[model samples]
Target: MKEKRYIMMVGAVDDQLSQVRASLTETMNQKNVITQWILSRDGIDAIGKVDNQKFDAMIIDAEAPRVLNADFLNGIGRHRNTNDCNIFVMSTQDQEQLHPNLQKYAFLQKPLQTEILLQGLSEALSQNLKPSMVEKFSVDVRVINALIKATMMVCQNYGLDQVDMEKPTPKLLELPWQGQSGAYLDIRSQVFSGGLILSFEKNVFLKIVSEMLGEPFTEIKPEISDAIGEISNIILGNAKSEFTSYGVEMTLPKILSLGQTIDQPAGSVSMLITFGTPMGKFFLEIIAHPRK
Candidate 1:
């Protein structure tokens, strides 16, 4: 059941809340949500609002006074409807300053873009969301998480400067991407079949490949496509043993050109796994069918 979401914005500092409002309003209509906003000039005031009412989501700015402590977080979530209430922490500082527990929640770079803000919100929503997906996908959440672990492993091997990922989200509509250069590998086992796709924006791809291959690439070249395939191979290869335990195996990667659309097989579900890097964001899409 889709319910009204009370979203509290703390330390807005300016007219930014309007930007968030506009963005959420645009997307909320598609998801059938009614978002109510609450404002606080500081964390102390925000604490009052949080304690008195139930909030599904709370966005806190780094500049919010007296909010960096664990006590604030400990207080804010108890009154939330779900134990997994969406909490976004925004900071201008490059290094993290929030409590260790708070660090796991969404952390946004300040001077934030409303578009990226919406993306962070969507990603956090996807993480905390749990309804009908397990039954519909017929796959355990552990399998999905293991895929994330495998992807992170590959990302680390490639020597990505920063490797932070949004938790996986299930996609119900057409998969939209800003960049078209990507690759996919077919995965199969006694219980699972489908494919895994690694995709990135053009600049992100160029930067990652350049760093991986020790060359400077300003634009797309045929070699870059091959590099994508090779990188994807390493990823699944690393996961092979782990997936073998789950009875999952993968085929060699197939490259996707600009604007190419992957054909989702019949009776399959796809999970969009987004990873944040110093360069930009890339995704690992698992389109899998868990057979009976």
Candidate 2:
């Protein structure tokens, strides 16, 4: 019999982690892959376990303080068994000035989709064991296609005008890109950091607000931001469930953002997908890297 693939999860309480676990588990079972999973509430517990056990892979939350810094990653990377194990870091913080070695690991941004996670896992599983030469996972393009279709359906069902979607454009913008209402999107590129940063023009946001609230937008209301966040949350929740074949599990949290510049870690990538709605143009960016 083949040895089961074991996955360890480290993170604070968040919806994204929960969704990740659930989705992955379903996928694993479907594929008839034997697997085990462990969850840690803090970084210390996570590191301790990794040091002691030989896990096939790790799904860690990048925002969790204990695991967020370079010291922790370095410590784990030094572990003898870790050389053959996979690491998946999830984060919403911006990555800047990350150590070069850490960039070789896998990363997932918040509001993770199921297909993206599976792609990461598949890549990690396919790699030849080596020291720090982790495989990178690309978001399954089919998932993105479905998401675009879903967004259009939701808009039309909700009585909003249909939008035209274009192929995504790849570009790297400055971190903490300013958006409307004093909000900013921060970008990061390295491990254990936020996946991508998206800044929306104030006017464009207001249009979404008006449609969601069924009222004309005169000013930036706090409720408007909350609504946008909710929309994002719903979209991600649905997307994360699309990977039922890999036994990967996850819990996505409600979207929340302070009206400040969002900070993300370094070594990240972003793909801009624009949609032309009857009201105006809207955009959604996919930011992440494959697991090594």
lDDT of 2 by residue, 34-126 (tens): 557777776678777776678777777666666656556677677775667877665554222334454445545455544556655644443
TM-score of each: 0.53, 0.43
Candidate 2 backbone clash number: 54
Query: Among these predicted structures, which one has the highest TM-score?
Result: 1
Q: What are the clash counts of all predictions, listed in order?
A: 0, 54
What C-alpha lDDT, on a 0 to 100 scale, does residue 75 get in candidate 1?
Answer: 68
Q: Give the TM-score of candidate 2.
A: 0.43
In angstroms, give how far residue 264 of model 2 lies from its true place: 36
- Each model's lDDT comes to 0.65, 0.54
Q: How close is candidate 1 to the true structure, as a TM-score?
A: 0.53
Residue 14 deviation, candidate 2, in Å?
3.0
